[model samples]
Target chain A: MTRPGFTGSALDRADPIRQDPAALAAARADAGARLLRMDGIDPVVGPDGLLDWGGLDEAPPGAFLALLGLIGGSPRFVALSGIPGGAQRSPLMMELLDAWPPEEAATYAAARSLIDWHARHPFCARCGAETAPIRGGWARSCPRCRTEHFPRVDPVVIMLAEHRGRVLVGRQASWKPGRYSALAGFVEPGESVEEAVARELHEEAGILATDIRYLASQPWPFPSQLMIACVARTANDALTIDRHELDHAMWVDRAGVEAALAKLPGAPFDPPPAYAIAHSLFRMWLDG
Target chain B: MTRPGFTGSALDRADPIRQDPAALAAARADAGARLLRMDGIDPVVGPDGLLDWGGLDEAPPGAFLALLGLIGGSPRFVALSGIPGGAQRSPLMMELLDAWPPEEAATYAAARSLIDWHARHPFCARCGAETAPIRGGWARSCPRCRTEHFPRVDPVVIMLAEHRGRVLVGRQASWKPGRYSALAGFVEPGESVEEAVARELHEEAGILATDIRYLASQPWPFPSQLMIACVARTANDALTIDRHELDHAMWVDRAGVEAALAKLPGAPFDPPPAYAIAHSLFRMWLDG
Candidate 1:
């Protein structure tokens, strides 16, 4: 089973072709080359419910074209802040993902993440010098120190903790009123994914997770995160919630999980949808 | 089997305890708190080949302590550019790791990574304002925009690609005359670890890998990298070396891999030592 939001993309990231400045310029001059403009982190969506793609002639002056990839034989590029008019910008949310096909959704997610990275990393971390984009926007190089910096995709562990017949879940204070998800946290500097799973479970919900198993991974690029999903077995049912990290946490049996997974109309507490790894975990646990 | 290097550490990263400045101060003044000072990226290693841990009184004036964790019943902190005279500062290398136990080596790795992160991220990426350390050095917060940034651990896929009784290996131009290792590359913005394995294999060595299996993971904190090791089977054995990325690419039989792994007194080309995931991958492949 595949997690839905951003899995499919047909773009061929022709690394060698993009390296040639002349070739890249030729692609930009081609009428078939599409330009996707971003306003901040959101892509400008036209009234047709899709990203407004236009030719280079229509692009604003001084627009820096960040090559996305080749869609079929034509090149696709994304830019930050150069939408002409008549289009509304929107953040990539669940509803938008649901309305689009997987391939288009994945491409949009990739573009948004790259655009966000470029916006933030304008200066070199090592030398405090202004950096310039290189390798057709795949990397940035500090001219002073010559340090090449690539886009950052932070790894996060999201685990479904099971003890006997129950699954452990927790709700964050910032989450919706009755929504709970599998315990999740970023993998720290010097730790494995399994270790992160155990540490996060214990810290957030006081559950001692063991027998950790890697289930799957998804590109959860809500500003670039790689969600590594796992199934962990916990021995203790008791949870001493760290109130600072979680609002509430508890053990829910298979039936309770199934009820939430059903997504019944007006259900108070809802499990994550098909677009999230949490929903995939619940379905896997229930099937087992 | 546990992978060697940066896997064993008994320190309880008491994150909750770190949130309270008053409690952290109390821990600092408790006399049981031990401080390990780092000069730039290297930790202060004593003549006895161990981190010289001492009380807060031993720390230099105006030294800022980054909390490592509670080792046993005491808090452990690491400072940068704080140690005064006598001790030699060194990077956490394989020779040093060979001298120290796994626990100590891992702790040093963690401390060094955190220290390096703090050194580089003095400015905010979001607002272009100076950032201040928070969460006891686990994170930094921008004063202007209040955006929190955590230490980055980039995920890299290092794989032993096998085709019909031989393993594929390559060496870069910058490497020593005859040092080769498994094909490896960093995981990019939008791909799974498995997909990364396939992509990197094709890109570097012109091998189409299939049936990818997760072997193990190790923390290679030469400024923070998580090496995810895997074993992939390739049906086609043809090699088209990307000269720009690799100096040499070739297939080695089981006997050749065994000879390299043995590190015979004056071997021409040797596999990495036990401290690296590349060595572990070689061992696993050799054993099979």
Candidate 2:
């Protein structure tokens, strides 16, 4: 099994109900239906430090309710942008990554991504028509053009480049002090994951890589991205960083990575947290 | 490497130039800028059966030109709904999959997907405002909402299930006679790829799977999808077909699959074509 924040859920996405308007309405009225509310991207949490599943009566009007799935014979819905004012909300998504169990974290990730999509897509891109939530908020349908829009999940290639017993890591300009992670970028329209890996490595650090191998995938819901993790073997170690894309990049030996992972006193940089695929990739390389 | 139709292109997207309107206008007049026109979903082909890269001078007015990349120091663009009246056009995307080389075929796939996206998304989904093509057709921006919309690629799980030396294959209700392929479905909003594979297997064929492994992936541009190919081992082989989803599902031994692959006289059913990831999975299982 992958580490937490990757993807694992107990909810059975009863998708057939999504197409049935009457069934969806009935689900909303069902007493067993639980509501997971979101205030913008931040999830509303109860005093117990878990997702506050509130009653449907407490949800605000015009809130978009996305049917997450049937968990234990109860239909669960995630309400976006409809929290009645004065509800306690948690911090941003990254901060709440580990606050819940794996299944609950995955649920929050799904709800957050869906909510983000709904927030961004309110009009029909097909004909400048207003699109209303349909199919239990799993889809948006344009009233004029009749175009149905589903949620989007962008594929990204995040790779760990190993060369001569050292792994290449880069720090983005926006990251905190002394923080570095694997080189990553969005997969372009026409490229394979392998091609994306090679292109990102060369573009970000001026390193040419071969022997690319896919590791695993994690669903990153900082707005619906599928992080396809990979490892590549590089022949050259010299670095030419693109200042526009990265602040700095360098090769770190196993000991250095271990120190960073352990947060030793003299570690050169802080590695990504255990919730990230970057951390998994680093650990895999160090252990292998 | 993965099977053909997965991905192939060495073109540097040079995406930064996409934001520069001056660069885009210059490319439009560069004489070397070749345009691939699409009439709806079909590419305008020349008499010689190649993608007709016509001169920009002949393009129709108000054509949506999607910048593919800088191929060999020249820009390549795909124009949607702008084929000249006299040019010969291919039937549709699926029919022309094998007409071009692997790289060119991959390019056509990308172009077709982008064109489809442009055709469907003409308005902003956020505020019901008209959206204009921006970033060289890679994205659309709403004039009122200031929201940017990018191309979407949906993820699907296509898996081959094997148990006791017999592989499971199913035929969808809509397929032609004697055609059976791998069990496949879209990955739901919250589940991992592993969960998708298992869920699809059980939902479609009443099989419980274990030992799920990712084999390969293909960019299936039948309206923009990323086909994630996998293989799983089943603990029990009892077959219970869901009539709504599949007409029939059965386990085939190695000899049966080999016979079908070879097109033997007494073969029970026909497998998927070589261009499909289903064919690759079957080939891998048989060869291994």
Candidate 3:
């Protein structure tokens, strides 16, 4: 029998093209688009037609992105592509960034995360002086102290909980209204993903997770977060929400989620669409 | 009952203080260390005792290297601390690189891996241009392209196979005389760890694995690799070693491994010492 969880199909998926770097580069360069400078415009296409932030006049293009192999969604890459600009101006310019297709979004997400990291980190932490990038921007060396720094991607654990066939969802104050999603938190330095999962569940929903199973992972590039999704079985049903972290939380059964997805008349809440892991989990529960 | 496999303790634990930016900065400042000039050294430290065939300089002074976090056997972080004069030297300067604790060779292994990654990635891969270190040297960015690059750690699958009570292991061509370890290989893009485990076993020893279960993970930083360790139950036990990948292969019953661990004079070969995961796997076989 299949485990009652979503097995992550997004991380490792076979693709013929991504295997050949030269072919991939040729295809990308031929896409009839000016390689946008990451530091110049906020790579994301927002509500506006054009990104307002200053963009670079010219950039030396190279293969700075890690072409992460395709998952079910699409082939992805970590964008190391940058334009001669800083973070402060680019955020505003991102207002002009336009919506991207699925593949482009995935690629953009990876690129944005890498570029954003570069915009922020220009000095060595060890010596508090300027450093130089090395290893194709995978590393940096401190000029003053001779220390090196590498890019950092914080690991965040996200999970869906199934209790008596009802799924648990939490909404943060910063999220869209009635837009409850999976519970998540950063993995600490010494903590395992399992430990992080348990801690996040306990802190956000006051629910203790017992049987935790791996689901899937997504590269969330808003600032380079690896979202690890899991299916967690709840031990205690009693709700004890942490108001400081989550504004509200509840256990919505599969039928209720289906209704929300339908946008049924008079529905008080709605789950995100199929694209999100939360919605995927909800759909899985309904299918079961 | 636990399966016959590796023993992983949250052992070799270092305090979280090492990753603290403030503490690390303070330590470096107190040492009177100055940041090395980025343009001063060649990107690659060649075989000679110099970078780009340059003369050696004294190591950086007052620069203290803090232990970065350990992944499995790899320890990773921003920079290594050393005397200022030692900064420009080549192979001798390698000593200034972070070394793992004597008791924690695995941790040293992680450090080795990360250091190796830094060595390979010094330029912006995207534009093939120079990049700068950022985020306290944990990351790098291309100035022209504005792409950020972070150290990459690849994943590998290492597994021990069991059929009834017999455990399977393989010896690589370069392995020391009489030394044998579990079969392993890089996790190919689009392949799950489980799939990789099965493929590697089949390729190395022609064994088909069933019921593959993840046991533990170690950061093998030999060049930034994460060794996803697992235990698999073999579907059948007929021997067919792939000559190219394996110098030798066999199925050893529990008593044989136990005897090897006990250092019995007659044992053909012993696994890695007690400090290694291989030894732990061997021990688990005995216990089972």
Question: Of the pair 1 and 3, which is ahead by TM-score?
Answer: 1
lDDT of 2 by residue, A1-288 (tens): 445355666677776677778888889889999887665567777778767787776667877777888889899987766322212335465566755666677888788777777777777766777678888888888777677778877878899999988899899888889999999998766566777798899888889999888887777776677887889999798898978899999889999999999999999789887767888788877777
True contacts kept of each: 0.47, 0.47, 0.00
Interface RMSD to the true structure, each candidate = 1.7, 1.8, 8.5
Flag the better candidate by lDDT, 1 or 2. Answer: 2
Candidate 2: stretches off by over 4 Å: A1-6, A21-26, A37-40, A62-64, A82-93, B37-40, B46-49, B62-64, B82-95
Q: Between 2 and 3, whose DockQ is larger?
A: 2
Instruction: Evaluate every candidate with DockQ and list the scores.
Output: 0.53, 0.54, 0.06
In candidate 2, list every pair of residues with a backbone clash.
A122-B125, A122-B126, A123-B125, A123-B126, A125-B122, A125-B123
Instruction: Give per-model TM-scores.
Output: 0.90, 0.91, 0.52
User: Least accurate stretch of 10 residues (summed lDDT) in model 3 chain B?
Assistant: B49-58
Q: After superposition, how far is residue B199 of candidate 1 from its true place, in Å?
A: 1.8
lDDT of 1 by residue, A96-187 (tens): 76677666667877787777787777777655678777777788888887878789988888999999988888898988778988989988
Cα RMSDs, all models:
3.8, 3.5, 12.0
The residue-by-residue lDDT of candidate 3 on B1-288, one tens digit each, is 232111122223333334356754553444333222222221233354222212112224543233443335343333333223212335432342222222233323333433444444556644556666554444566788687766555556678899988888778788778887777776543234565677677766777889887654444433454555678998999888877668888888777887777778877566764434566556655665
